[model samples]
Target: MALNLNDLQIFVQAVDSGGFAAAARRLGMPKSTISKRVAALEADLETRLLHRTSRSFMLTDPGRDFYEHALAALIEAEAAESAVRQRHAEPSGIVRITASVPAAQFFLSDHLPSLAVAYPKLTLQLHATDRFVDLVQEGFDIAVRNHFAPLPDSELLQRQVSIDEVILVAAPSYLEKHGFPADPRDLKNHAGLLVSQTAKAWRLHHVDQGTISVSPHCRFIADETLVLLRAAASGLGIACLPETGCKAAMEHGQIVRVLPGWTAGTVATSILTTHRRGQLPGVRAVVEFLAKGFQAERAATGNVLEPLRETTEARS
Candidate 1:
């Protein structure tokens, strides 16, 4: 008897999701139905694939080997379907995107409405998180990320969107109490709210003075950029954040740039997608939209760190 693709797909989903219930929820099917189908698949194969338990399950040796091949097969099947769909002129399908929380909140979300208007038939599923998700494993179509270091080596295709300037900021009341630093070295005397994922030392560059690295004494540390922004706004400590993330706060007077003339550093923003998946219309449209949007934003904002020298020299 021929192997059933439907049953194989269900088995893969169950394993990938970590349990039958999760697979059911993801697939929008009943848990019992999923379990039955997988069980039927095992029966047809005449081999036990999973070691079941009340609370969890584990794959048997044979199951692991089978899973490897099954996953590849499923990917091929999807590629085949996508290839056929791409032949159509209009872009219409679900495009799953993953991005860091700050990027999603400050940058991507604001531009999504425009994407919807441009591609009416396209559906978008956004996963906002700081964790680096596996694009192939998670079945995501594209990922948007901001990083100071080179992206880890991968087969995924990456397009550089923009170089976002990082700036130091604090609330008005905090600045009033602690007094503004006269120089980059003075930042050590003030409280610091640090983004834990970034480099411990803040490296600021001046065209004439070259680069100076300062390691601020952190009063608080968090993985999320938004949390660091909020901490800075509440006067907990000064924080280093992307200009885009703090633009609204600066505009609203909730936070002010601490070292106006000096910048921490620039982080690269890139959009990543698998080579095969990038060929799909829906995925291609989103990538183009985001790349253009970032360019427009950079043009409008100018170089936020450029005017700092005048302001700093005036204070001197």
Candidate 2:
């Protein structure tokens, strides 16, 4: 049966405050109004909850029983409200996040130690996979997606956190053995460590010559970037890689940048959330931390990471 919570509250308050007159003062209402609401509550329940005389009142058998349950219900309801408020106010609890394996390895896992230090009460569960999963059904708090083009329409909130310039790279041994390519078209002669996500033709962009598409002789192909990076480092072939992903290898002299003036493309990383507003503090904290961490990493590497912006979900 449906019960009016307001009436239940009023009835409880009227009884606890000793009388309608006292409850009226506490609630800042007329005594008659309080009496009428309490009476209405009893009428709805079809039970006499109070026996009253000129100046005194007492609870009947059913009244005592109802009062106990009503008081407990009110306490639990208030506690539920308080719990939500508290959770919203503080960054705590577990945040389940998902991202591509390379992103999780290079972009995300590194910042976790500091994030834990900052938010000691919060825990993050990382799920690394290449396939896209439904954030709501999968119970993910946030997702990191890297794309070369605009993402498809989604109900989830999308905020771009970082942008990496895609660059061509190869082990120094490979370049020394095969000679460096002076032109984008020359890549067709050199072996290629291709990424499965890209088309057969590698489309590169140059400032003056514009975009050039080269169908290199692929020696190895993999969907995961980490594998391609390793293959390129081993001098298997020249591979296209994000500047950020290959930064360490370049510094360590394991690989060198190829076609210095040309870029393969640009890939942007974005965070997706189920709801932009009223999110749990832990979820919001993770999102902000990831955004800042990516931006800071790009800054240190001299790459321009674009500022965060909310995306509009396109509808068909």
Task: Identify the leading candidate in terms of lDDT.
Answer: 2
| Candidate 1 TM-score, C-alpha based | 0.66
Candidate 2 error regions (>4 Å): 1-20, 23-88, 276-278, 312-316
Model 1 lDDT, residue 233, Cα: 96
Could you tell me which 10 consecutive residues in candidate 2 have the lowest summed lDDT? 307-316
* Cα deviation of 171, candidate 2, in Å: 0.9
lDDT of each: 0.84, 0.85
Worst lDDT window (10 residues) for model 1?
307-316
Per-prediction TM-score to the true structure, in the order listed: 0.66, 0.72
Per-residue alpha-carbon lDDT of model 2 for 85-141, expressed as tens digits? Answer: 866686988988889787887888788888988999998888998787888888888
What candidate 1 gets wrong by more than 4 Å, as runs, is: 1-88, 197-200, 304-316
Residue 125, candidate 2: Cα error in Å is: 0.8
